[model samples]
Target: MDRFEVLSVFFGHKTAASVVAAHSHPYWQLEIVTHGGLRCAFAGDGFALEAGDMLLVPPECEHGFVYDKPGVSWITIRFERAEDGESRWGGVIRGRPFTDRLVSSFKIAIPGSADKPYEKAFVGGFLDALLHYIRSDEFRQPADSPGALLGQITDMVLARGGRAVTVSELAEELSYTRSHLSKKFRAIAGESLKAYIDRLRVQKAEELLKYREDSISEIAADLGFGDLFSFSRFVKKHTGASPRELKGK
Candidate 1:
C-alpha cells in the first residue's frame, strides 16, 4: 500500500539575518511560512516566499532559506514513504494557498506531539489532503543540474559526522576547483562554504549536548575542535552561549 509516515513536525521562528544553509533530508519536507518572508533556494533557483507561502520539497532535494524580515515564523512537517517504496507525489510545489478552513482545522486538530495512534492518523490524513491539493494542479518545476551537484556536496559534508571537511577536499573529491564549488554553493545557499560548515557543526553540537550525556571535552573532540577553549569560542560565536550553558538547558 502507498502510505506516508509522519516523522516529525517543528514550528520555527527566525529573526532577521537568520540563515538555514543548504541541506537535504531523506524525507519529504512541507514548509509553510506563517509570518514575514524569506527566500528559499533549491536546485539553483530561488523563490521569494512570503506569508502563507507553502513549499513542498521532495526527498533529498537541496534547499535552504534566508530570512528577509524580522520574526519569520514557519511550520515544517517531515514525512517519509512507507509500505510501497514509491512516493505518492512528484516534483516541488511552491506558494500554494491552504484554505482558511483547512488552516484553522490544522490548528485545532494537530497534536502537540505525535505519540498516540490517533495523533499519527490525524497527521497522516492531513498530509494526504495536502498532497492531493498540491497534485491537483499541473505545476511542475524541473531540477537544476548545478543544484543537484550542490546537494551531493551537502550530503558529503553531513556524512563526515564529527570529522571536519574542507572545501579543498570536497572540491577534489567532486573533481571541481575550490573556487568553482565555493561560488556555486554561495549562489545557491546564500552562505559561504566555511560559514555553512560552522553552522552545521554548531547544530550538531547542540543536538549532542541536549540529547547525549557526553562531556563538553568529548563533544568538542567529536566536533573536530582542537580544544575545549576553541569549541567554547565557536559555540559562543554562533549561539551567543557557552557549551556549559547550552548543555545545562
Candidate 2:
C-alpha cells in the first residue's frame, strides 16, 4: 500500500502583514485554514479562504500566500507523492467536517512512533478520501441547509476521535429536535439521522479496527458501544460483517 511519507507539518498563526514568496517544489502541499483568512494566487487564479477551507498544491505548481488579516491560523502539511497514490490534487479545495477532523488528526501523528507506518497509511488514506470527495458534486451538500447542520454533527463526532456520542446529546448540543434533525437529515442526505450516524460509526470503527492496536472492547468503547457484543451486532447488522471480519482478521 502507498504511504504518504509525510515530509513536514507546520502549525502557525500570524497577524502581521506577510507575503510568502511565490515558489514551487517537487512534492505536494496541503494547506488548511483553521482560523481567520488567507489570500493566495494559485496557477494564475486567485483565491481566498477562511476557517475550514483548504487547498492542495501539486508538485511544481507555483503558488504563494498573503496573510493580511489578524488571527490567521493554518496547518500546512507537505509530503512526497506516494509511490502508488492518486495522480494529484491542486488548486483551492473546499472543506468538509470529516475532512477537517481528519486533517486535525495529523496533530497526533507524532514522529518516531511505533505506529508510524499506520500513520503514513492513515495520511495517505485521508488524501485518497479527500480526493474522492472533492471530485464529486454529490458530496457538496447545500450550505446553511440541513446537510450543513448534519456537517456540524459530523464535526463533533469526528473531533471526539471515536468517543461515543448519543443522538440525544447531539440533538441537545445543536438545539434541534430529534424529529426535525432526522427529517432534515434524511431529506438532504437521503438517509435517516440514525442510519447516517450508524454508517459513520461503522466507517470509523473499521478504520480503528484495521490497525489492530486497540482491543475490540476498547474500540467498542471509543465508538460509544456499551459492550463488544453490541458493537459486533451493530457491525453485522449494518455491514453483514463482524468486527473481527472488518478488522481484516
Candidate 3:
C-alpha cells in the first residue's frame, strides 16, 4: 500500500506540563517555539528544548514530550509529497525527510482564536509567509546546500520507516559525532531523535491494533519486536489494554 502525507503549520501555547507517549507521525513535524519550554522523549532518550528552538521529526519517529509551565507558544510546519513517493506524519510532512538545520524564525503575530475570521486569515497568511521563508535562504547558508542536507535526511528517515535506528548510526550517516548531531537535531526539530522514534513505534502499534487486519503477534514482528510477549507488554503499558482486547473492542 502507498503511504499518505499532509502539510500544515500552526502555533500553540500551554499552561502546564503534559507528557505525551511515544508515537509516530502520520506526517512530518516541524515545530518552532517562541515562548516556554518542552521536554521530549525520542528514540529512547529525553531532551529539554526551550524557546528560540525548532524540531524536525520524520514520520514514524517515535517521540513525545511535556509542555512546561504556561504561556508557551510555537509554530509547526508539516510537509509531504502528494503521491506514492512521499509518506508523512498526520498533519505533518515526513516525505523526503531532512536533517535539522537552523532556520530563521518566521513569526506571524496575530491575536485571536481559530474560530475568529481574522484569526483564520492571519494564520493563512502566516502559513504562506512561512513556506516562502523556508523556500528562501535566510535560514540556510551556502545557498541551498545546507538546507538541502536537512531535507535529505528527513526524506531518508521517512522513506526507510525510521525503526530501530540508533543515534550512532544516524550520526555516522550524516558524518557527525552523535553529540553534535543530537544538538543540531534538537535545535531544529524541537525534540531529541530517540524520543521521536519511540513514539513512532508505539503509535504504529496502536494503529495496527485499531485499524489493520494483522494479529497482535504479526504486528509485533512487523514492528521488529523480538517476541509477542514484549509487544503485548508494551501495548498494555501504553494503552492499558492487551492487543487482543484492543482489537476485540
Give the number of the best model, judged by lDDT. Answer: 2
lDDT of 2 by residue, 1-249 (tens): 335667766777897989998899999898889889999989988899888889889899999999999889987878876555456658776676666666676556633322466666766677777767776553566556665676687777766666666777788888888777667777877877777677777788888998859888888987778888988998889888898887876
Model 2, position 153: C-alpha lDDT score = 75
After superposition, which runs of candidate 1 have C-alpha atoms over 4 Å from their true positions?
83-98, 137-249
lDDT (C-alpha) at residue 11 in model 1: 75
Can you rank all candidates by lDDT, best first? 2, 1, 3
Q: Roughly what TM-score does model 1 have, to 2 decimal places?
A: 0.49
Q: lDDT for every model?
A: 0.75, 0.76, 0.60
lDDT against true structure, model 3: 0.60
**Which runs in model 2 stand beyond 4 Å of their true positions?**
1-7, 82-87, 111-168, 171-179, 188-249
Model 1 agreement with the true structure over 36-139: per-residue lDDT tens digits: 88898876688888776677888788899888688898888888866444363533344422333455576577635566787777778887777665544322
RMSD (Å) of each candidate, 1 decimal = 18.5, 6.3, 20.4
Global CA lDDT of candidate 2, please? 0.76
Question: Candidate 2 has what TM-score?
Answer: 0.59
